[model samples]
Target: MSAADADTVLFIPGLWIHSDSWAPWAALYEKAGYTAIVEGWPGQAATPAETRRNPAPLDGVGLEAITEHYARLILQLPAVPVVIGHSFGGVVAQKLLARGLASRAVAVDPGPIKGVTKLPFAQIRSALPVVKSKKNRSTTVALTRKQFRFGFGNALPKSESDALFSRWAIPGPGRPLFEATEAKKTDKSPAQIDTRLADRGPLLIIGGGKDHTVPEVVTRQEFELYDTPAITDYKVFADRGHSLVFDSNWKQIADYTLSWVAAHRVNA
Candidate 1:
């Protein structure tokens, strides 16, 4: 098909990772005859450097705000598009799918939602910087090099991990982390996704074997939660960590996503 007539794919980035990190993925999608829309969260600056210089705009941005922002973006498009997201972005992606706003979705190492009860130690440790205190709920939290290594780059070499941190890391709102970590506690949590929609579009949940933030078990639970008869699939990168989407081997995951979407023949 001509690029002009091809499907659309919207890329969403997680915490501490800049929207620019999706540039390579967007290039790949555009080359594959897809309309690629890559944008930062509601309060994120135009670039990572700009966001780091003044992250005040990102403070107090919560899951509800993030989810609604994407909802509006999708509504403005000609048709519902394929949504791909990692980390907290993944959480919002699933919520979009639940609302029947996406043609298809791929959630990579998505954060814990309302029904998920699995709280692994590493997951707790990875979120401690933001979730440890209520004071952080209304502020933006920066990831230290050390914390980034543990949460996003455990499978990568120290040099590459450091370089990735230097290039893409930015302060992210703490409200989402607080909402995710304390999801089950809320009576009507915004982190909940209705995974039982029988007529919903296809979904593929990817998990990284060494991901500290959202472990393999967490992704597995998320996939299983979809009792719907609609297509729901799960894949794992056995040696990767949470940084799989932007790390050196990002093409592997991107190519896999393209192939999956082609094979399923999901609609726009």
Candidate 2:
């Protein structure tokens, strides 16, 4: 397809993650004939050194700010892109879809949004250290081995999980975690991803069977909220966790996503 005709693919990372985290996946999308773009949150640069050296807290950063930043970037793309988002980014993808930004979206273990009534113990515990502090707005929380094992590595081998922890793990903003905690109570939290714009495009929700942070049950439950008849799909990786996109089998996941886009894109 011509440059103008070929579809674009944008990869948005989760909280405290940098664009480099999606480098492998971006190459995969490029090989599949899709232009790829990786975006970060406002004031959130996609670099491990910067993220680690001066990790910022999530205070004052609300969902509206996030949505607007991504929306403006999406509007600048030449072609409507297929957004593939992980964790908090998945929530952002849902919100973008609601506003008609993309032709389709893939929410891989998206973070809790408004009205999601369930909060797993593991998730709460992983977030306790930061949320307990009232001045946590400026604090950063690093994922310890235990925290990663329970929330993101229950199904992976220790070596693999350990490597991931050492390589990509960094401090994440605490505000979103705190906001997501109260997402069920108020609509103002940063986790409020409105999948209500279900008709704007097709959506695929991928669940990590062992993901304590975003358990399969909750992922499955959230799928039902996309009430539109716009061809929503769901899948669960039995041995996967929150790090599904970064796993060794990521190629398979990427292939599946590319196939879905080819089948449902605007120019398909």
- Say which candidate scores most in lDDT: 1
lDDT of 2 by residue, 1-268 (tens): 1223236788987864565778888998898887889877776645776767766634355556677888888777776678889988888888877767877889998887777777777667656766888566555666778777667767789888887777677777676777777777774566666655535777888888878778887788888776676778998887777878886777777888878878876643
Model 1 RMSD, rounded to 1 decimal: 2.5
Overall local distance difference test of candidate 2 = 0.75
Q: What's the true lDDT of residue 221 in model 2?
A: 82
- Predictions in order: lDDT: 0.89, 0.75
- Cα lDDT for residue 7, model 1? 87
Query: Which RMSD values do the candidates have, in order?
Result: 2.5, 2.9
Provide backbone clash counts, one per model.
Answer: 0, 0
Model 1's TM-score against the true structure:
0.96
